[model samples]
Target chain A: MTTTLRTRQRFAKAGVLTGLVIGGLFAALPVLWMLSTSLKSNGEVFQNPPQLITESFSFDAYAEILGNGAQLRFFLNSYIVAFAVTVLTLLVAILAGYAFSRFTFPGQKTINAVIVSVQAVPPITLVIPYFGLVVALGLYNTYPGLILTHMVFTLPYAIIMITAYLNTLPKELDESVKVDGGTSWTALWRILVPISVPGLIAVGVYTFMISWNEYLFALTLTRTDDMRTVPIGIQLLMGQHSYEWNQMMAMSILGSIPVLVLFLLFQRRFIGGLTAGAVKA
Target chain B: MTSTTAPDTTAPTQEPVTPDRPRTTLTRRLSPFGYLSPTIVLIVVLMVIPIVMVISYSFRDNVIVQENSVFAGLANYTTVLTDPNFLAALKNTAIFITVSTVAHLILGLAFAMMLNTQLLGGVTKAIFRIVYILPWLFTIAVIAVIWRLLLDPSGVVNYVLQTLGLLQEGVNWLSDPGKALWAVTFVNIWSGYPFFMISLLAGLQGIPNDLYEAAAVDGANPVQRFLNVTLPQLRPVIISMAVLDLIWTSQQFALIWMLTGGGPLNVTEVLSTFTYKQAFSEYEFATASAAAVIVLLLTMVLAFFYVRLQKER
Candidate 1:
């Protein structure tokens, strides 16, 4: 009996280890190969036996991407657009979240429902009309066009998350200011916003990530190399270079750095918040 | 006013009228709308108006490009619904989303379970967790690029498979009509599963230790315990994730766009690509608008169920 139990324990351990290794490889090997290829010379990309690490590994691809004015412009546009989207989303969402959490507004449920359902509106649905509107308004191929449209995507999630976060904090935190003859607006800035920094951080990080990674709008709204975000820039690079494999890999890595760094910094908060809808119940 | 369904503990149902201060009551009354104004305006211009415009556009002929657009009634819808390519896109989208969601759920649950094992150290699990989430970290564009390289005819993936006797020759993954849909779907699964894994990992941790202990005392083996306890405990999260995944996976365009361009005789063409081609490539905005509206309505039906499910819980 003891021998059987011991054997079962051994098998379980082996099973777990095997599963972990295979899963780790599945998730990591392609990413690893991308990094390896970025380091390799473009000519070596299709060598009969692909090596994860090449002796010819150097920073040529990275240098090429960083040194180019057009490529660097993609990074700049991404930062400008994503940063604008994050700040604006946070401000708008915070105020809306405040209202949802604090007051019993007349159309609160309806408005909230509208915001929630807004997420279900596929981007493809909006792109056509947006093309008409943006062109009509002469905002086509501009930052304002991209920024405004991306907010439609970012704001709903941010509002829901911030509202959920604020709901966790007792109303008394803000109400105390109101009792002291201060307005709710002042109380929000002074008390609620300050205390809600962590939640706001999580929301801001997510907003930035969404805007940073956004493709469809950025692709449609912008018409120039200087205006294109990194994702679109990567696609352009694929077309322009055709088969400059190392350069393409390098661009992808560079493009991914901001969100990757942000994820690494706040994985726990971001993941916890994202899956809260699933897990909180 | 129906704060009954809010589910947040600290959210009070209504604002208490502090009778002492008229100013406070006034501020409370007016400020909610004031705070909400920006959101309202943005949502109106950006979401509501655009949706209205799209619906209206769907009824017209040559709306965007032509100056004298005509009211075509159901003509645009008929054109879209009758188009064989649109029908192909609809079928492909269903398969793509269903396969992707199921694969995501399975892979997510397995990884979550493995990572949640009691025998492993937290540090070890954390490293593996990072590895597991690596794919989800990259943009869909980067994912598209990386996979394209890997699935290249003479690429490392083929090299490994051929050497392992899995395939006799390098398969042209993206360009091949038979394999294009599955190749793109596989990439979709790869980039998508980490989110489900994260959610499921959190769900797994939330399952109580005492429940498992009780099951063990009741002579339940691991599999039996998992079936009776773990699965039941995780049902809510699983359903929620499944519905959410279905909604998202169906809407996936960027990955399919960047990877295959819905090409090789449109084998990988999904609704989003079909609509995009109609508007941008083919310049048939009215038909694209009809297709887009169909996609929207399909998403809403799924979302309606998701919201209802959440309310039920």
Candidate 2:
């Protein structure tokens, strides 16, 4: 009976190992294939018995993409817009989270409910009206237009996460500062903000990812290639040089690097804060 | 302590370190708004006004493309509701979201459960966890491009399947009318399941091992222990993830647009693509606004359930 039980346990372990390997391949194989194809020449892409590691591998695709002025502009635009969005979102979310966490006022419940519900407002719904709004305000094809619009989507989650983070902190921290002749604003900047770095980093990284990946608004609001971000730049790559699969793959890998780096660097805090915001709040 | 707090005396002047005690006056009551002004301004400008504009646009006749659009009471809504293509989009969205959400939940739970097993070392589990999350790190645009490469008729996917004797020949996965919707849905599942997996893994870690031991001591099998303890413990997480997935998957536009362009006879034209085409490609802003509103209402319904689920938890 002991031998039988041990055998069964071994079989179960083997089954699980098999499942993990298959699932890992399912998830990671395409990503590896993308990296491989990015290194290969365009002609090597459709080679019979498609290669995961091409014999003719080179950095020529990455060089072509990086050297091209138009493609480089996409990277620059994405960085500027993503960084700006992250900063602006953290600023606004910190203040709003302070309000929600520390104070009571009329219509607080209503305001909180509205903010939570704001996440549901479909972007397609807003895109039409924003087309008219952006053009009317003379902000079309501009950085501020994208930054402001992206904030609406990012702010709700940030405020929710940051508020939850702040609620765990004692109100006496603020109170003692007030007693020491520090204003609410001073206490916020000096004490609360410093301690909330981990939460803020999580929100900041998620915000950057959203703005970096945004496509519909970028497509609709911007007309010129000068203002287009990476996602749209990829689309244009498909159009401008039909089936330049190597360059397209290279641009995608380059486009994904920032968010990928951020996630790897802050994987634990990111997931913790994300689950709290997304699952809890 | 700076002089900044000297002039800010209120009820807190007497007892400075009180724990959010009731304000003695109205002037003192509205203080938090100082910090909240930026958020309120953004909410009003970005959310409140645009939503109002979209609703009003739905009532008007081709507003964005034309200078003067008249208020046509419920006319655009009627047109969208009656149009066969609109209906087709709605039907496809239902299938896409339903299948994608179910698959995500199942795959998420299975991988999460397996990773939660004590059979593996922490290093092994951590490696698998990162591997599982790999698909989710790429942007949807990159995901679209990668899949397009793989699903090409002569792509690696066909080569493997053909070698395994599973297919007689290569199939055009994206362009084929019979397969486009499924192809797009599969990509979404790939990119989306990790989120559910992460959440469920957290939920699994939260379940105590004592419960499993107790069930085993009672002669309960592995399946019985899972059904009895694991599923009930996880029901809340599953519901929340499913509702959120429905909203996210329903709003997917970039993936479909990039992969198939809702093409091959509109087989994969989900609501987002349908609405986008009406507004941009066809320049029928009126009907698109109406369709957009419908999509909004549908998402609100899902989100309402989500907020309520959070409250319940």
Candidate 3:
């Protein structure tokens, strides 16, 4: 019986290992393919029985993409918009999260409810109205327009995450600051913000990713090549006559690097933030 | 001695300073608003106001080019509801959501279970987790493009399949009307399942081993232990994740737009893409807004349940 049990356990372990390996490959295959395709020349991309790894590896696609000033502009635009959105979101979210976590005030429940409901509203629903609004305000094709629109999604997310993080902290810290005759501002800026650096960083990274990956608003709001973000730029690469598959793949890989780096650097905190935001909320 | 006695005498005087407490209480009552004002103002301008405007636009006969709004009451809604394209989009969205959500949940649970078994070393497991979530981290545009290349008629998928003798010739996955919707649904599942995986893994980790041990002592097998112990523990997480996934997958636009553009005769025309086409492609703002309002109402109902779920937890 002991031997049988050991055999069954070993079989189960092997099954699990097999499943993990398969799942990992399934997850990584498309990305690996993208890398492979990006390194291939155009002719190789279209070759019969497409090569997983081309014999003649070339950086021509990357070079072509980097050589294009418009592509670089898209990258710059994305960086600016993402950075601005992250800062704006973090500032608003920290203040609002601190309030929600610490204070019991009039209309608090209503505001909280509004925030929650707003998050549930699908962003595409507002695209038309926002288009009209932005055009009317003459903010179309502008960075501020995209930044403000991106905040509609990011602010609520950041606020909720920061609030959840703050909820885990003791209230005594604020009270102690109060006892020290320090104002609420001092408590937040001095006591809470310093301690909540990890949470703040998580929210910042989340906001940056959202803005960087945003497409619909970027597509609708920005008209000029200079204002278009990376995603839009990539879409434009697929013109009617010629689909620059290699260069598009190169740009896609380039666009993903910031997010990948952020995830790799803050893997634990980022995952914790995501799981905490989802599971708890 | 005098100093101690003086403070003792002063303590009685300090007790009468309760009059200031009400004023402080008044500030306390208003301060949350002060902190929340920025968020409130931004949401009002960006989200709340736009939502209200969209709803109003749905009631008017508005065109993007014309910029003239004449109240048409429910005419726009009627038009959208009766349109064949709109009906098709609604049906397609339902099918997509049902299939994608189920696929993600099942596959995600399987992946989570495998990961939870600890069959691999710590480093290997960590690498697997990262690999699984890489798709989720990738931008939808990038994901769409990568998948487009893979699913193209002459793409690697067909090449590999043909090499393995699974197909006699390359199949047009994206351009074929019959397969386009399912193709995009597959992509959605690929990128989306990791969300469920991570959440379920977290849920699984939270389950105590003692429960499983107790079930084993009760002569329960592995499947029985899972059904009896794990399912009940994971119920809340599953429900919440499923609900959120429903909203998200329903609103998905970029992937479909990039991969197929609701193409091959609008086989994958979801409500989001439908609305986009009406507004931008056709310049029919009122009709598009009406469709969007319908989508909003559907998601709002789910959101109501989601809120209740959160409160229950």
DockQ top scorer: 2
**Order of models, best TM-score first:** 2, 1, 3
Q: Estimate, for each residue in A1-281, the C-alpha lDDT of model 1 and write its tens digit.
A: 99998898889888898999999999999999999999999988999777877779899999999999999999999999999999999999998998898878688889999998888788999999999999999999999999999999999999999889989999778767756765666677899999989889888998999999999999988897889999999999999977899999999999999999999999888888888844542
Fill in the DockQ of model 1.
0.60
- Fraction of real interface contacts that model 3 preserves: 0.75
Per-residue error for B251 in candidate 1, Å, reads: 0.9
The TM-scores of chain A alone, one per candidate, are: 0.97, 0.98, 0.97
TM-score of 3: 0.95
Task: Return the DockQ of model 2.
Answer: 0.67
lDDT score of residue A250 within candidate 3? 96
Summing lDDT over every window of 10 consecutive residues in candidate 3 chain B, give the lowest-scoring window.
B1-10
| Root-mean-square deviation per candidate | 3.8, 2.6, 5.0
> Which residue pairs in model 3 clash with each other?
none
Clashing pairs in 2: none
Score every model by TM-score: 0.96, 0.96, 0.95
- Model 1 per-residue lDDT at B61: 91
| DockQ-based class of model 1 | medium
What's model 1's lDDT at A228?
Answer: 96
- Write the candidate numbers in order of decreasing DockQ: 2, 1, 3
